[model samples]
Target: MAWYGQIEQLQTIFDELERLLPSGAQLTSFIATTVHFMDCLINNQRGNLFTNVYHNSTVRPFLLPYIPSYARLSHRKWFRYAFIHAFHYYCSFEDFEDERIYIEAIFLANGYSLDFVKYHWRQFLKRFNFSLIELTDLN
Candidate 1:
């Protein structure tokens, strides 16, 4: 009964969130979606449930609509430092068996968009068996 109550609460929240911000919405809707995603994160912490909420997402996609037309990404070594910490944090939690994480890390390091990586996910998957040095050699 208690779990069902939590599910109901989440459903209510998502209902209001999606009603206001359907996919490919305007800039304001994009911003609101980001807020909703954050709220979703705050509400979930068990790390074991497959809620299909914001946990299954990356922040860049929501914020991309808000980015200006003149926006550009300049890859720098400093950014790698932060990513190193983030990558290790995820690795520490997982068994380090998922190759997709490493490929995603490389894409992020090179300033690639999530959509780009996802589109080429199959090619990335083929490289899963590559050695550590081989992984680093990817473009």
Candidate 2:
């Protein structure tokens, strides 16, 4: 098929897909250097692609509350899991630190003490053999 015919075919497909969606919602597409999908921000700089975690502004931050009614072990496990998630998703140290602060705030608002968060954060760094300086320098 000719290149122009292929373009028309692609447009027709996109129109059909948009019609399948509910009313008032449109299927928009892009051909760009950057794209945000699900929870990831992806970028193509030249030929190298980079990805980092993406948070939508409309969404609120939430985590399991560290209240007395819940088991302490469960609270601790979830607390540590937040750190693990931050480490896994953030490609840059600056982004990770921002996420770290956000994580602490969410827990604090949900009743976890600052001391509790600080101690676990320190332990997490230690277990990963990461000093504050090293973490910053490496990323």
56: Cα error in model 1, Å: 15
Task: Kindly state the number of residue pairs that clash in model 1.
Answer: 0
Q: Estimate each model's TM-score.
A: 0.23, 0.60
What candidate 1 gets wrong by more than 4 Å, as runs, is 1-5, 22-89, 97-139
Model 2 alpha-carbon drift over 4 Å, by segment:
1-38, 45-48, 56-59, 63-70
lDDT score, candidate 1: 0.41
- Candidate 2, overall lDDT? 0.76
Weakest 10 consecutive residues of candidate 1 by summed lDDT: 26-35
What tens digits encode model 2's per-residue C-alpha lDDT throughout 1-139?
A: 1123466677887899898989989787765678887777778777667666676777666655437788765776776777887787777889889888888887888787899889989988888888999879747
- The best candidate by lDDT is 2
For candidate 2, the C-alpha RMSD (Å) to the true structure equals: 7.0
* Residue-level error in angstroms, candidate 2, position 70: 5.2
Which digits, one per residue and each the tens of the lDDT, describe model 1 over residues 36-102?
A: 4432322224433221123334544322223355445433222333233333334222323243465
lDDT of each: 0.41, 0.76
